[model samples]
Target chain A: MFDNIDKTDINELGEFGLIKHLTQTVELTQESSNKGIGDDAAVLDFSGYKTLISTDLLLENIHFDLRYVPLKHLGYKAVQVNLSDIYAMNGIASQITFSIGLSSKFPLEAIEEIYEGALIACKKYGVDLIGGDTSASAQGLVISVTSIGYAKEEKIAYRSGAQEGDLLCVSGDLGGAYVGLQLLEREKQIYLENPNIQPDLEGKDYIVERQLKPEARKDVIDLLAHLDITPTSMIDVSDGLASEILHICNASNVGCKLYEEKIPLDPMTYETAREFGLDPTVCALSGGEDYELLFTIPQADYDKVKGQLDISVIGYITEPAAGKEMISKSGHVHEIKAQGWNAFKNKS
Target chain B: MFDNIDKTDINELGEFGLIKHLTQTVELTQESSNKGIGDDAAVLDFSGYKTLISTDLLLENIHFDLRYVPLKHLGYKAVQVNLSDIYAMNGIASQITFSIGLSSKFPLEAIEEIYEGALIACKKYGVDLIGGDTSASAQGLVISVTSIGYAKEEKIAYRSGAQEGDLLCVSGDLGGAYVGLQLLEREKQIYLENPNIQPDLEGKDYIVERQLKPEARKDVIDLLAHLDITPTSMIDVSDGLASEILHICNASNVGCKLYEEKIPLDPMTYETAREFGLDPTVCALSGGEDYELLFTIPQADYDKVKGQLDISVIGYITEPAAGKEMISKSGHVHEIKAQGWNAFKNKS
Candidate 1:
C-alpha cells in the first residue's frame, strides 16, 4: 500500500537546508508580521512598537550532559539562553512560553528543581512565564523556550544595520563559558575513572559559573539607553565571537578588523585555558556560549557609550572588499573562520 | 565535586508542580504584561488589544506512534491541535513559532513534506509562521509550536464563565478520531504481521481522515459571532468529550447531565466500533482528538445558534449539588469518569 519514494538523509540538507525547506512554504497571513524566518528573531509590527519572537531548543545528551549539569541550573540556563537572543536585538523580554519533554523515569521533585532554577532566572531577568506544554519522552529530556519582547521602531537593532567605519564593541568577558565547559568535562572524566576522588575545581569558580549559569545582557541595553546611544548593529555571542562577527559583517555588507588585545578575557578563563593546554586567544575567538552582546556603534556615538557600559572597543567595521580579518598582538594578521560547535559532527 | 543532595523524579510533582516551580520565580518587569502563568495563555495588554500566547509539544512516540501514521498528516495535525486551544478561548491566531527536533535518519525530502503539510494548515487558519528552531535528535522527531493571537478584552472567553442552567453544546461529529486511531492501528498490525498482504483502507477514509487531519473549530467561533450569540464558556474536545465536560463542570462550579442519544456519532465511527467490539456510545463519549468545540450557551440565546452551526445540544448545566452523570438510552444513569489518554501512565 506504500509507494516507493527515495528518502534523502537529513544530514545531506544540513541545518540550513532543513530550515529553508520548512519555512519556504509558509505565507504570511497577518499584516502585523513585517518580517519572518531570516533573523535572530521574527519581527512584528505591534502598532507603534515592534515585537520580536525567537525560540531555542536544548536536548539532554546533545546540548547538556546530565552527568555533570544539575537539573536546576539546566532549567534556568534554558530560559536565559533564549532571552539572550532578545537582548541581542536590543529589546526587553516581556513573556516566555516553555515546553519540556521528559522521560517517565524522572521523579516529580527533579522536574520541580529544574523549574526552580528556571524561576530564579526569570525573576532575575524580569520576564514572565506565560504558557507551555509538558509530555513524556522515550529517552531523554528536552526543553524548548520561545521569548517575546518589544522595542520602539527606532530603538530596534538588527545584524544588518552595521555601517562602514562603525566601531565594534563587546560587553563582558569572552572564553569563560567555553573554558568552564572544558573544566566540567575534565572533572566528569576524573570522577568516572575514580568515584572516590573529588573534583579539584579551586579558583575556577568564575569560569565554571559562566558555563553553568550564563546571564542575558539585558543590562547592556538599559545602559545604552541611559547613555543615549543606540547601536548600528548587534547580536548575542552564543556561537563564538568569530562566527557572530562574520554574521554582522555578512549581513551589513562590511568587513571588520578585531584587535586581539582588545578582546575581553577573564583571568580565570586565561588560567583554565593554560591548564587545558589550549591557546587562550583561540578560546576567546572561537569558544561559544558567552551570552554577551557584540555590537557596532557609529563613530559619532562612540564617545557617548565609551564608559557608560562595561564594554571594550574591539575593532572597526571596514568596506566589504577589505574582508574580515583579525590583528594579533604579534602584529600578524589572520583570516577569521567559523568552527563553532557543530552538533551533527560532535554528537557521540 | 559531588554534593550529596536528595534526588527526586519529575513524575512525583506531575505537570502542575513543574509549571508552578518555573513560574513562581518569573518577574513581570514590563508593564505590558497584565496577566501571566495561570490562564490558557499569557495576556499581554498591548494598548487596546490583549495578546494571548500558548504553546504545545508533540513527540513521535508519546503523542503519535509514526508506525501507523503518515508524516504529512502528523505535521498538519500538530498545527491544528495547538490552534484549537486558541480558538477554544475565543481568539484568532496571528502568528506561530515552530521548533523541530529531528533525527538524522529521516531524509531531507521527508522533512520538507512535513513542512508542506504545515504550510497548508497555516494558510487555512490565517496564521503566519514567524520563527522556529531546528536541531538534530538522537532518536525520534519532536515538534513544539507556540501560537500568538489577540482578542478584545470583553470578548475573551474563559473556562470559568459558564453559569448554572446554561446549555452544553458541541460542534460537528465526535468520537470519529478515536475510532480512526483504532482502525489505523489494526491495519498497521495486519500489515506488519504479513508484508505480502495488500490492506484495504478505501472504505474507512472518513474515519482515517478524522484521525490524521483533524481541523480546529475556528468556524464555530466565527459562526457564533455572526449569529450574535457568545458562549458563556468553551474548550476544545481534545481530551475526549467526557473529560472536557468534567473540566467545564469543575471550572464553572456546576454539574451536567449528558444524554447519550444526543451525542453526535458518524456512521463510519459506529461501524468501526462494532467491528472492533467496542461500545459506540463509549467511543463517542470518551474518544479524543476530535478537535471539536465543547461550549455552554445561555438558554436565553439558544434560539440564535440553534441552526446557525453544526451543533448538538447533548446536555445542560445544573446546580453543583446534582454532580456529573450521563443518562443511557435504556433509562439508566451512570457517573461520568474520565479515562482519557494519559501520557505519563502510557509511556511505560
Candidate 2:
C-alpha cells in the first residue's frame, strides 16, 4: 500500500515535510469536523452534542516488546485503546490526534509503517486524524493517542451510574489477550534460546491475534444503541475485570457480586492457559488489554440483553455496605482486589 | 511545599491510586466541563460553540535537556505550548488531558512535583483536567498534553484566512527563549569543566525565565477581543517566526514581506545574541519555542490595533506571485527560509 516508500531517509523530508507527506491524502468526511489539519488547531463543531475526550500513552518495551510486536499493530492498538475509552462512554469516536516521539534508531520507513496502520484504523472507524505533534525521542518510541467523540446527552453512560440490582455484564470473552501474550512470550523465549529454530505458532492464531491487535467495542456500543438499551454504568476492560469493577464500585458508591461461572472465556484461552499451568480465571481477572466493554444495566433491561450472544451477564450490583465480592465456581466469596499496572511501582 | 511527600513508593498506591492522589484537588471551574476526571472519558458540553483541539508531545533530552530544566518548569511549559495553539485560533481553552510516560528512575515525589506544576497552570487558565492515561516508560520522561477549547463561529481565526494586503502582526518579543538556551548551555559546559565555580547567571533572569517557564499568550487573545479586532489569519510561534509565517502563507496561498526593523525584541535578547556572535534577526527568524502568537489583520483593522501596547505590525501580506520576502534593516529584500527545528534534519 505504501508504494515507493522504501528507503528514503527521514531527514531528507524534514519534520513538517514528512508530516505533510503522510497526511496529504487524508480527507475530511465529517461535517462536524469544520477544519482538519493545516491549522493551529482542528476546529470541531459539536453543537447540540456531548463531546467525549480521552487520551492514552504507549511506551515501547514497557507497554509492548517491539521484538515480538509489529510496528503496524502497535500503532493500531494505540488508537484502539483510546477509542475504546470513548466507546465505553457510549460515544461515537469522530476524530483522533496521533502524536509520536520517535527515537534515532527508527527509519522513515518504520515511521511510515506505523502511520499506515494508524491511517487504516482511522479509516475503518470513521474517525478523522486531526492535529498532533511529531518529535524526536532520545530513546525509544512514544505513542500518544487522544480520541474525541460525541454522543446525544441521554445516551451517555458514566461509571458512577450503577445502582443496586443492576446486572453486571461484559461484551466478548476475556483472558484471550493475556493467553496470547503468554504464547508470544513463550515463542520469543524459544527464539532467544535458539535463533535457528522455527518456533511453533500455527494453531495459536486466535490468542496471538487477540494479543497483538485487540479491537475496540465500537460495534457493541452500536448494538446497544440498536437494542434501545443504555448501560447504567460502563467502562472498558483494559486493566482486567477486577480493576475495572472496583473502579465502578468506588465511583458509584456501590458493591458488586461477580460469579466466576458466568464469566466468558474462549475455549482456546482456557485450554492454552491450563497448558501453561495458569488458571484462566486468574488471567482474565488481572491480565488486562482486552478492550472489551464491561457495563451494568437495570433488571428491566436484562431481558433485552439476554438475546444478544456476545453479551454475558457475569454479576449484579449491591448496596455499598456489602463491599465488592467475587464468587468462585465452588461457591466461595472473596473480596475483589486491584492488581493493575503501576508505572512507578513496577520493580522499584 | 511538597515536603511531606518524600519517598513514597509509587507501587504502594498503584496506578489508579496514584492518579487519584495527584488529581484529587483539581477543581473544575469551566462551565463547559460536564465531567472532570474519574470516568472512561471526560464529558464536555460545548453546545452552540465550535470546539478547538490541539495536541503537543514533549520528549526528554530531545525537546529539553533535564540537566538544566526543572521538572516543574518542564511541566508548566508543556501545558503552555499546547494551550498556545488553541489560543492562536481565537479560542478559550476549557479542558486538557495530560498523559505522561514516566521512567522508573523518577520517584513518587518527583512525579508529584511535575503534577503540581501542571495543576497550577491548569487552575490559572481555568481549564479542567479531564482524562488521561499514564504508563511506564522504559526510557525517559515523556509528557503529552491535549488541549480542547471553544470558539464562537464568527470569532474564530484560521491560518488560511489571510488575504492580500492584510497586515502581519505579532504579540510580545521574540528570540528570548533561544538566547536563554544559549546561556544555559554555556553555563552547563562551564559547570562540567569546573565544579567549584558557580556558573554566571547574574542578570540573565529575563531570558532564562522566558525559556524555562514560557507562558501561553492568553492575554493577547483577550486583548484582541477587547480591541474588537479579529485576526485574518493566525498561528502560534512554536516554530520560528519565519517558519510560522511560511506556514500561514502556504495555508493562505499568499506572500509576505516581513520588516526587520519592525520585529520586536527585548533588550536582553538583542544584546545576548550579539554576545554570542549571532545576529538578533537571525535568532528571531530561526530560533523557536517563543510561544508568541503571530497573526494578520485586514488593513482596515490597523487603526483598531494601533494603540495596542505589546502588538507589533511587522509585515504585510502580498500577492502569491510576489513570494515570501523579508526586508533587512539596511533595506535589502531576501526570501525568507525555514530554518526552524527539524528534529531529523538538524543533524543530517
Candidate 3:
C-alpha cells in the first residue's frame, strides 16, 4: 500500500490529463501490441493465432466493499479475474483494456494507487495495457476490464469439447477465497463496534490474502503445455466448484460423479470455515471467487497429470443418464446442487 | 421504445440464466468470430490483420439521464459511441463486448429492451455481439462497451501522422448533439414543473434524434476508401471540434488554422443555439458527442474529397511556430481553446 500524503484534486488534472498521467509508465512488451494508449483505439497484430476475448464488470458495494478492500488489491484482483477467463480457454492473455468510473470522493492519489496495482498485474502477467476510458461516477467506483489473448487453434479448449469418461481435475485448493471473505466480514463487524480493536487478524494472513489478491492460474496452463496435455474442456472456478461442474456437464451434454473427499481444501480455509460454523465441503462446493482453473482430460492421458502436486483429480465424466452426483465422505450419494454467487437474488 | 407491460422478476432467472436468455438471439456473422457466448472467453481469429481495440464507460445520471433517455436508445447509443472509436481509426468494427451493471429496480423486461436495442445496432453495423458480463448494481445502470476491429497494416491511421500542409476535414455536421441536449434539458425542466406538459418537441425531432441516437460515421470511412484517399491522421469528434483539433496538433507537433465559416452545422442546430442565446460557432467548437470523423489529408488529395456533400474542409494544418488559431467570420484571429466534455470538472 502507498501513502496519500499529497492530496491532489482530480479536477486539477481533468479526465484526459489524469488518463495520460496514470498510463505514462505503461510500456508494451508484447509483440502483438502495435499500439498502446494515445489513439482512437489500440492496435494489435495477432497473425496466425486465434484471439481470445473476455470481459468482467465489477461495481462497488455489490461486487466488493471498499471498507475491507484496499484500492490496490481491488485493482489487481479485477485484472486477475478477467485473465482467469483467458486461461480457462487455455490461452495466454496479451493485452487488456481497463475502464474505471469513480466519484469525486476519491482523490488523485487514491486513483493512482489503483492504477499502480493494475499495471503491476499486467507487467507480472506479461500483458499490455492497451486502451481504456476514465470518467467520474455518480457514486462509488466502477471497473470494467476486457482481456485479449491468443492461442493455437488446436490447443484451444471449449466447454462442449468434453467427452464421457474424461477425468475431472482442478488446480490449487478451493474455498480459500470464500472463507477468506467470511474472516474479513467478521473482522469488519468487530472493528465497527470498537474501531480501536485493531482487527484481530493475526495468523490469518493466508486466507486474507486469498480474498484480497486471488491469482489467475497461468502457471498451471504453462505446466499443461510443458506436459503435452490439453484439457478436453476447461473453465475457471469463479462461481464455486459445484456450479462450474454443472456448467461443464450441461455444455458437454454429460454428467459427472465427484468424490467429496477428493475436493482440495487448504488447512486455513477448513479451520476458518469451521470456526464460522460452516461446513468446509459446502464452502468449497458453494463458496466462490476462487480463481483456480478446472478442467478435464481423457482417461488415456491421465498418466501425464498423475501425481501433479498442484492438481487434484476429484471426478470423472459420465453419461448424461447418470446425472450429476457427489459421493459424500460418509458413503452417501447426493445430487450436486449449485448455490453459485448470485448477485441478483439478494439484491432483488 | 418498447413497452414494459410485464414486470418479470430478474431474480427468477439469476445472473447466468439472464445472460443466456438475453444473448440467445445473437448469431456470429463475422468470419473472424470462431466462438462467442457459452464460453469463458470469446474466440476470434484476426489472422493477418492488425486488430483495433477501444473501450468506453457510461454511468447513469452521470453520462445519461434515464428520465428522458429510453433504455433502448441508451443501449444503442452505448454501442454506437464505442464503435465510433474504431471508425475513427479507419477500421471496420467486427465485434463488441457489452457489459452492464444495473440495479434491481430494472425488471427483466427492461433489461430485455436494452439488449434488443444493442442487438439491433450490432446487426445493422455488421458487428457481432461476441461476449459480455451482466451483474446487479447497487445503484443506477452502468454500461461498458469494448469494440474490436481490424485493418491492414498500411491502412491504419494514427493521430501523430498529420503533416503541416495537411488539409483538416470533418465528416457530417457538428454541434447538433450538443444543442439537441440543450433542447432536451429545457423540455425536461418544463416536464418537471408540470407533468401534464407533453414536451414541445414537435419540429425538434431532428436535433432530438441527434442527441438520443447518434450514429458513428462508418459511411464516411467507406467513402474515403472508395475514393482511394488515405488520411494522414484521423480521430472521432467525440470531444468537440476544437478539442480534437488540439489533440491532432499536439500529437502531430503542428499547428492549425480552423475557419469559423467552414464549420458545419445543421439548420436546426444553428437556430436552436441562437434561440438559447448561445453562439452557434461556440457550440460547434466546444460541444462534444458529435461522433463524426475528423481527419487530415495531404494537399494532393484535396481534389479527391472536393465537392463531397458530407465532407467539409474546415481548416489546414500549419507549422508548429504558427500556433493554434481560429479565424472568425469578421477576419479576426483568436487562439483556439478546448472546453470539451470533462466529467471531473464540475463534480469535484
Candidate 4:
C-alpha cells in the first residue's frame, strides 16, 4: 500500500519537470558510473573501455501511424533511433535489447514483421540483438529499445565539450523528414476525403524516405576516425537543428552564430516546402527527425572535412556573452529560438 | 521501400516463435559478447567482471488493471520484475534504464507517480536509474525496463548448470500471488457491477499484498553467499513453479521428481483456493508471478541450507530418461506438464 501524494496534475510539471523529479532521488553507488543522468547516454567506466547506455520509446499513434507507415520500417527505425543516441556519444553500438508491448488485437504476423525490420537494422549496423521481453498490451503497440555501445575513453564525445571558436558542422541535409511527414499527412487527408481515390506520392521520394526510414549517422563517426578529426562536441539532430544547437550552447556554456545561406537543404525539400506554402529555411531550421549528426570541430580540423560532400559548415561556437544568433541572407542578425517538436504543445 | 511480404498473423507463430525468429538473425561481432540470447540474460565479458543484461515489458490492461492497481505500486513492481531476472542469475544489479510509453489520457502527475515507484525500487535494490525515454502513446501505457548486473565469472550461475542427483529448492511460499490476483479481480468485478457497494477484504491482506507487490528474492542470493553455497542451476518463479522446473530440467538436460507434499504453500493461499473451489496444489504448481527463486544445488552443499527456514526442498534432479514426474501424497506418480500462463491461450 502506497501513501497518497499530493494530487498534482502531470501537465503542470511537464516532461522536463517529471524527469528532474524522478532523477533527483536516484543515488549512484557504482564507482564505474562516471555519469548517471542528463546526457545523450549514461557513461560507465568499464575495464579498458567506456560504455554508453541509452534507450528510446516509440508508441503507436503518437510516434508512428501504421496506416501509412510499414511495420518493417517502424522496427528498423526504432533500433536506429536508439543507436543514434550512442552515435551522438561517438561510440560504436555493440548490443541492443528490444522490448515490445503488443496489443491483443495484433496478429502474430504483425509482431514478426516488426522484428524482421529490427533484424535488418541490427545486421546493417553490426550490432547484436542480445535480449528482450514480449508482453500483451491493453491498447496500441509500444516498442522500447536500449542500445549499449563502447568507445576508447579519450574518443568519447559529450554535448558539453564545445569551446569558443569551434566550427559547428552537420551531416547530410535537413528538413526532409519534417516535409516528408507533411506529404504523408496530406495524402492521408485526400484518401479520407474520397475512398475511391488512390493517393499520389510521385517525385517526393527523398523527403518521404527521410520521414519513413531515417538512418543513424554512424558513417560520420567512421569518417571522423579516418580523417583523424575528433569532434569537440556532438549530438544527433532528432529535435530539429535549432533545438539541438540550443542544447549544445546551453550545455557548453557558450553561444553560437549560424549562417542562413550555409544551412543544408535538399532541393526537393525546398520545392516541397514552396508547394505547401511554407518557408524552406524555416523547415530546415525547426523541422525535427532529421537524424543527422551535429558536431563542433576545432578550426584546425575544418580543412580535413571542408570538401566532403555530405558535410556542411553551418555555424561557429561563440563566447557566452555574444549570445546565440543566426545571420539572415539579407545580413541581419536574429536570435535563434527553438520551436522544435513538442508533443505537449501540439496536442489538442 | 520494403518488398511486400504477405503479412503473417502473429498468432500463427506464437510468442516463442516470434522470439526465436527475431533472435535467429542476430549476429554478434563484439568479442565482449561471450554469449547472446537463449539464456536468462546475455553474458558480456566486460574486462575483469562478467556483465549480464535482461529486459522486461509491462503493458497496461494486459499486465495490470488500473482499477485495483495504484500508479506507485505499478512503477515499483516494474523495476522489481526486471531485477528478479538478475536475481535469477545470482548477480547484483548495477544499473537500469526505464522507458515509458504514456497515453494522452494520463496526466503528468500520473507519470510522476509511476516514476516515484520506480525510484523507490531502485533505491531499495541499490541500482542506479541511468537512462530512459518518455514518449506519448496513442493508447494505453507501457513500461520497459532493462537491468544490467555484474558478477565474478566463477560465481555466475546459469540455468544449464544442474546435474543429475542435484536437489531442487525453492525460496519462500508459493501460490499466494495467484490467489491474491483472484481476490483483486473479484473485488473489481463487484465494484464494477455495483458502484454503491463497499466490498469486504478484511482477512485477505497477505494474498492481496502478494498480488500487488511481489518481492524479488535478492536476499536468497545473499543467503547462498553467506552459506558458501552456489546453485548449480537457477531461475525465478515468474511463469509458475512447474514451468520454471521444466526450464531448469530442459536446459540442464535432466529430469526431476517433485513431491507434492514437499511443495510449500502459504496457509492463506490454501484457504483462499478452497473458498474459490480451486485445488490448492494446482495453484501452487501452475499459478504465476510468485517472484520466488527456484534453484538446484548439489548434494554436497545440501546440508549448508538444510536448516534454512524459508527454503523447501521439493524435488531431486535425475537422468533425462527418468522424465519429469510428481509423486503425490498417495504414492501415485504423474508426469508433470507445464500449464503456466500462456497469453495466447483461448479464453471464454
TM-score of the A chain in candidate 3: the value is: 0.98
Q: In order, what are the TM-scores of chain A for the candidates? A: 0.86, 0.97, 0.98, 0.86
lDDT of 4 at A25: 37
Q: Model 2, range A28-142, lDDT digits (tens) per residue?
A: 8777899988888999999889999999888888888887888899888888988999999999999999988886567788888788888888998999999787877888888
**How many clashes in candidate 4?**
9
- Chain B TM-score (model 2 vs. true structure): 0.97
Model 2 vs. true fold: TM: 0.97
The CAPRI category of model 1 is incorrect
Model 4 CAPRI rating: incorrect
State residue B64's C-alpha deviation in candidate 4, in Å.
0.4
- lDDT per residue as tens, model 1, A99-144: 7787755655566656678767777877666555667787788898
Clashing residue pair totals per candidate (backbone < 3 A): 10, 0, 0, 9
B1-348: candidate 3 lDDT, tens digit per residue: 235468888989999989989998899999999999889999999888999999999998889998799889999999999999999999999999999899888889999878888888899999999999999999889999999999998998899999988999999999999999999999999999998999888899888888999999899999999999989999999889999999999999999999999999999999999999989988888888989999999999999999899999999999999999999999999999999888999576
Residue range B1-348, candidate 1, lDDT tens digits:
002223343333333343343234334434454433332123243555556666788888888887767777887888999888878878777666666776656554456556767767877887766556666677788888887666666666677778988999999999899899898888888989997877678789999999999999889889888887778888888878998888888878899899999899988899889999999888877788899999999999888867754988989999989989999999899898887766665654
Best by TM-score: 3
- Tens-digit per-residue lDDT, B1-348, candidate 4: 012223333333332343444334334444454434432122343676656677877887777888889888999999988888888888777667776776556654566667778878877877766656666666777888988776676666678789999999999999999999888889889999998977677999998888888889989999999998888888899878998888888878899999999999999999999999998889988998999999999999888988999888999999999999999999999999888865434110
Distance from true location, Cα of B323 in model 1, Å:
1.6
Where is model 1 chain B poorest over a 10-residue stretch in terms of lDDT?
A: B1-10
Which docking category, incorrect, acceptable, medium or high, applies to candidate 2? medium
List the candidates' TM-scores in order. 0.85, 0.97, 0.98, 0.86
Interface RMSD of each: 11.9, 1.4, 0.7, 12.2
